[model samples]
Target: MNLKLKEKIRESLSAVLPITGIVLMISIFLIPMELGTIVMFLTGAIMLIVGMGFFQLGAEMSMTPIGEGVGVQISKLKKLITVLLTGLIMGIIITISEPDLQILANQVPSVPNMVLIITVALGVGLFLALALVRIRYKISLSVLLIICYAALILTSFFVPKEFLAVAFDSGGVTTGPMTVPFIMAVGVGLASVRSDKNSADDSFGLVALSSIGPILAVLILGCFYKPTQAAYVLEDVETVVTTQDVARIFARGLPLYAREVLIALLPIIVVFFIFQMLTGRYHKWQIRRIMIGFIYTYIGLVLFLCGANVGFAPVGAYLGKQLAELSFNWILLPLGALIGYYIVKAEPAIQVLNHQVETVTNGAISVKMMDHCMSIGVAASVALAMLRVLTGVSIHWFVIPGYFIALVLSRFVPDIFIGIAFDSGGVASGPMTSTFLLPLSIGVCEALGGNLMTDAFGVVALVALTPLIAIQLMGLVYKLKTGKGTPTERAVIADDCDMIVDLEEDE
Candidate 1:
C-alpha cells in the first residue's frame, strides 16, 4: 500500500473505531440487534474506514490540485464577467459531483432529483461566483453571510412547511467531499495571487458562501413545488446472513453506486482536461498523477456510497426504531449525542476541512482543537435533532436561533475564523450525516408516527447549523487568548511542515 494511503486508512480507523464501538455497545447493552444487522453494521464500518481513507487521499491529490488550478485561472481573468462566468460554471459542475447532494435528492420525493440537483447547483454556482468576487476584491465575509442568510430567512416564510427542512438541508449537502476540496482550493488559488495579511482570511469563506446558495435556491424551489410526505426506501437489515451473503449484498450495491460516482466524476474529469488544455498549467507527470487521483476518488466514493447507503443506513434506521420503542426512549438524546460526537470524526470532508484550516492558520487552529469543537457541536445538534424527533417540535425553533447565534459571533471572531466557523458548519455534515444520522432520525420519527419532512429531514440542516456557533465560540476563546492580532501573527507555530501540504511540489 502507498504510505499516504496507509496513513489515511489508519486515521480513518481512529475515527471509525469509536463509533463502531458505540454501535456495538448499543446493540449489546441497550438493544439486541439481529445477528445479520450486527454483521451488516460491522461490514459497513469496515467499508467506511477504507472508503474514507481513499476519499481523503483522493481529495488531497485530485480535488485540491484541481481547485487550485481553476481558482488561479479564474483569478487571472481580466474581465469580471469572465471570472463570474467561470465561477458559475465550475460551481455547477462541482456541485453535481457531490455524493451527499445526490443522497439528499434521492430522499426528497416531491421534487424530481434532477430538478432539485440542478437548482441547487445553480444556487451554488451563483454564490460561488459571488464568493470569488469577494475574494478578488476583499469584501466582508460577515456582511455577505448576513445578507445571504437574511434573504434565506425571509424567503423561508414563503416556502411550504413540508419543504422547508429539505431546503435548508440542500445547503448542507452541497458542502460535502466533492465540493469542499474544489471550493476551498479555488479560494486558496485566488488568494495566492495576493500577498496580504487578509488573503488567507478571504480564502476561508468560499465554502461558507457556497453553502448558502443551495439553501436559497431550494427555498425558492419550494415556493413553486409543493412537497408531499417523503418516500424513503429503508433498507431491510435481515437480508444478508453470512459472509458470502454480505459480499453478494455489497457486490450488488457496488455497480449502481459506482455508476453514480463515475457520472458524478465525469464533469470534473472534463474540467480537469479542459484546464490542462486551456492553461497548460500541469506537466505531463502532474496530469498522470491527477488521473490516478481521479481513479482513487472514484473507487473511494463507490465504496463509501455502498457502505453508507447499503450497509449502514438500514442498521441506523433499525437501531433508531428499536431505541425509540424502548421504555425509556429519552435515552435517544444522549445516545444520539454520543454517536454524533464521534460520527463527525468519520466524515471524510471534516478531516479535509480540518487539515486545510490547520495548515492555512499555521497550526493556530489545530486539527485536535477542531475535532473537539466539532464533536461538541455535533453532539448538541444530534441531541436537539432527537428531541425534535421525540416531541414533534418545530425545526424553526432551532434553525432560527442557531443561525442568529452563529451570525452574531461572526462579528466577534477573527475574519479567517469567521470563514472557518461557517464553512465548518457545512463540512461537519457530510456523507455520514446523510447516510446514518438522517436515517436514524427518520426511523425514530416513523416509529413515533411523526411528520417525517418536518420532524426528521432537518437533521442534516441541524448538523450543518450548530457547528457555526460552536466553532465561533472557540474562535472567541482564541481571540481572548491571543489578544487581538491577525490569525497569521497569532500562529503558535510557523507553517508546521507536517500539517501543510506543499501544493506546488505535489502538482
Candidate 2:
C-alpha cells in the first residue's frame, strides 16, 4: 500500500479502536452480549476502519476538488442570479444522493420515502442558495442563525407534536458525510475570491445554514400532513451462531449496500463530469486521479454503510434493550454519556471537520482541541437524551432551552467561532449517530414503553444541539486568553496602511 493510504488507515484505527474497546468492556462487564454478536461486532469494526481510510482519501481527492472548482467558477460569474441558480441545482442534486438521507426517509413511513427525500432536498437547495448569498454579501452569520432558529422554533408550535423531533432531526442528518466535505469546500472556494479580512470566517457557516433549510421545510410539511404517531419499524438482526454465519450475514448485506451506494454516487459523478466538460478545468491526469478517487469513495461507502447498518446497529439495539431491562435503568444515562464521548471520534465527517478547522485556522485551533471539545459536547447531548428516554421528558423541554443558550452564546464568541460552533453541531451528528445511536435509543424507548417519536426520536437533534454551545464556549475561552489581539491588530494595521497611502498620494 502507498504511504498515504497507510497513514489514513492508522488514523482510522485510532478513531475506531477506542469505541470498539468500550463496547467490549461493556459486553464483558455490564451487558454480557452473545459470543456470536461480539464476533460480528469485531468484524464490523475492522471494516469500519478500512472503509473510513479509503473514504477520507477519496473525499480529499474528489469531493474537495469538485466543490472548490464549482465554487470558484460560480463566483467568477459575478452574477447573483447565476450563483443562486447554481447553488440551488447543486444542492438538490447532492442532497438527493446522500446515503444518510435515504436511511432517514425510510424511517418516516407517514410520508412516502420519495416525498420526504424531495422535501428535504428542496429545503437544502433553497438554504444553500441563501448561504452563498450570505457569503457574497458579508452577512453576520450569528444573526442569520438566530433568526433562522427562532423562526424554526416558532413554526414548531403550529405543527403536530409528533413531527417536531423528526423535523429537527432532518436538519441534523442533511449535513452527513456525503454533504459536509463538498459543502465546506464550496464555502472555502467562495471565500477565496474575496480579499477581505473576514473571508475565512465566512467560509465556516455554509454547513450550518444548510442544516437549517431541512428543519424549515419539514416544519412546513408538518403543517400540511400530520402523523399522529411515527411509523418506525426497527430492522431485526439475524442470528449468527458461528463464524460462517457472521460471514454469511455480511455477504448478504454487501450487495444491497453496494447498490444503494452506487445509486447515491451516480448523480455526483455525472455532475463532476458535466463540470469538467463545461470548464475543461482538469487535465487528463487530474481527471484520472478523480476517477480513481470516485472508485475509492464507492467501495468505501459500500463497506462503511454495510458495516454500520448490519453490524453496529443490531448490537446497539440489542445492548440498549438489555441495559434498559436491568433493575437500575438509570444507568443508561451515564453509560450513554461515556459511549457518546468516544463515539464522536468514530464519525468520519467529524474527522473531516476537525482537520478542516485546523487547516483553516493555520493550526491556531488544533485538531486535538476540537476533538476534545466535540467529545464533551456529544457526551452531554447523549446523556441528556438518555435521561429523556428514562424519564419520558418532552424533547422541547431540552431542545428549546438548549438552542436558546446556544444562540445566546453566539453573540459573545468571535465571529469565526460562531460559525464553527453551529457547523460542528451538524458534523457531530453523522452516520454513527443515525445507525448506532438512533437504534440504541429506539431500543431503550421500546423497552421502557416510552413514546418513540417523542422520546427516542430527538436524540439526533440533541446530538446536533450541544456542540453549538460547547465549541462556542471554547472560542470564548480562546478569545479571553488571547485578548482578541488578531482581529484588533489587523484593523490597526489596515488603518495605518490607509494613512500611508493617503500621505503618499498627498506627496
Candidate 3:
C-alpha cells in the first residue's frame, strides 16, 4: 500500500518480466514443457523477482547500516576481550540467520544440520575475530590468504573426498544475504576510522577471511566422518490454473515468508534497537527509514525463498533429470555454463556486491567489468563442475590448482585487488548457486548414477573459487597496461615486495 513498497514490487516485477518472457519463449518454441509446469515457472518467477527486490532493499535499509553501526561502535572500544566477544556473538547470530547455510545443512545426511550449523558458526566467529584483528593491525590481505589457503590444501589430502565440495561451498554460502551486507558494512565502518587512503582496501577482506573459516572447519569434519548417502529433498511446487491464480499463489506464499524472514530478521532488529538505545547513534527519522526498509526486505526474502524453493528449484531439478535421461547428457555442461553466466545477473547479493565494488573503486572497477569477470568465473566453474558430474572428477583437482594460481597472482596484483578478488570469490556464490544450480547438479547426478554428495555438492565451492583467479587476473592485466616498467620485471619478485605498487595510495 505504501508508495515505496509499491514501487519496489513494480520494479521487481519489471526486472523479472524479461526472464519470465525468456522462459515462456523457450517453453513455447524450443522446449515443449507441460502447461502446469509453465504456470509453476511463471508463478515462481514473479515471487523470485518481488522477493529479490524486497530482500535487497531490506538489506540496504536494515542489515548494512546496522552492521556498519556496530563496526563503528566496536572500533571505538579499546579492550581486546570486548572486540573478540562481539565478533563471536555477531558471527554466531548472523550465520544462524543465514538461510542458505541452513539449506545446505538440511541437505547433508552424514552430519546433523545443527551440528554442521554450529561448526560453521564457530568457524565464522573465530575468523571474524581474526578479520577484526587484521583490520586493527593493518595486516596484509594477500599474505593472510596465502597462509589460510596453504592450510586448506594441506588438509584436503586427509579429508574425505566426498565432503570437499560441500566444505568449500560452506565457506561461500555462510556469507549469505543475512551475513554479507552486515559484515561488509562492518568492514567499512571499521575501516572508516583510519584516515589512510588504503583503508577501503581493508573493508573488503572480512568476507574473504570469514569464508576461509568454514572450509577449514568442514574439512576437519570431513576427516572425522564419511557421508556415503545423498539426501534428495524434493520441494512442493504450486500449480496455477489461470493468470488470476498467480495473485492468489503469491498472496498465500507471502505470509509464510513474511513469518520466516521476520523471524530470521528479528535478531538483528533487536540487536540494533538495543545498540541504538545505548549509543544514541541513529536519529528518529533514520530509525523510521530503516524500519520501512526492513519491511521491504522481509517481504522480498519471503517471496524470494518461497518462489525459489517452491517454483524454480523443482523445475531446475526436473530439467536436469530430463536432460540427463536423454542420450545427450554432455549437453548439460555447455548449457550449465550458459545458465551460470546469465544467472549471475539474478543473484541478489552479487548485484549488491558489484554495485559496492564499483562505488568503492570510484568506477575504476566498473559494474560491467565486475559482472563480466564474475560471469566468466562462474561459467568456468560451472563447466568444470558439470564435467565433474559427468566423469566423477574430484573437486580437489580443480580447487587446489585454481587457488594456487589465485594465491600466486595475489603477490603480483595490487593490494586492493587482492582484497576485492578474494571477496569476489565468496560473493560469486550467492543464493542462486545454492537454490538453483546445486539442485540442478543434484538432479543430473541422481539420473546418471553418480554420487550426488560427492559430485554435485561442491558446485558452489567451485563457483566461489574461480572468481579468486578471474578478478586477480583482471588486476594483473591492469598492472601490465599501466605500470611504469617492463611487464617481465613486474611479474617476478625476488626480495623487494614493494616494487609492484601501481596506485598504492588510492586514487
The sequence of per-residue lDDT tens digits that candidate 1 reaches over residues 1-507 is 999999999999999999999999998898898787788888888998999899889888999998888878887789999989988998998898887777778776688988988999999999999998898888899999989888999999999888888788778877888888888888888888889899888878898889999999989989898878786677767566678998888888899998889888998999888878889999999888888888888888788888888878888898889899999999999999999999999998899999998988889889988998899899999999999989888888999988887888787678988999888987887889888998899889888889988988899899999989878767766665566756763453223221222321242
Question: TM-score of each candidate?
Answer: 0.94, 0.94, 0.90
Question: Over 4 Å off in model 2, which ranges?
Answer: 485-507
lDDT of each: 0.86, 0.86, 0.79
Cand. 1 TM to true fold: 0.94
Query: For model 3, how does the per-residue alpha-carbon lDDT over 282-342 read when each residue is reduced to its tens digit?
Result: 9999999899888877777787888877678877777767778878678778877877776
lDDT of 2 by residue, 1-507 (tens): 968878887999999899899899989988887788888898889889999888888888888888888888878877899989989998999899889998888666478788888999999999999999998888899899989999988998998877888788878887898999899999888888878899889889989999999889988888888677777666766778888999999999999999988998999999999999899999999999888888888887888888888889988888888899999889898899999998999898888889889988899878887987898899999999899888888788988899998898788778989989999998888999988998899999999888888788888999999999888777766665566756764454345345333432464
Q: What pairs collide in candidate 3? A: none
- lDDT of candidate 3 vs native? 0.79
Question: What is the C-alpha RMSD, rounded to one decimal, of candidate 1?
Answer: 5.7
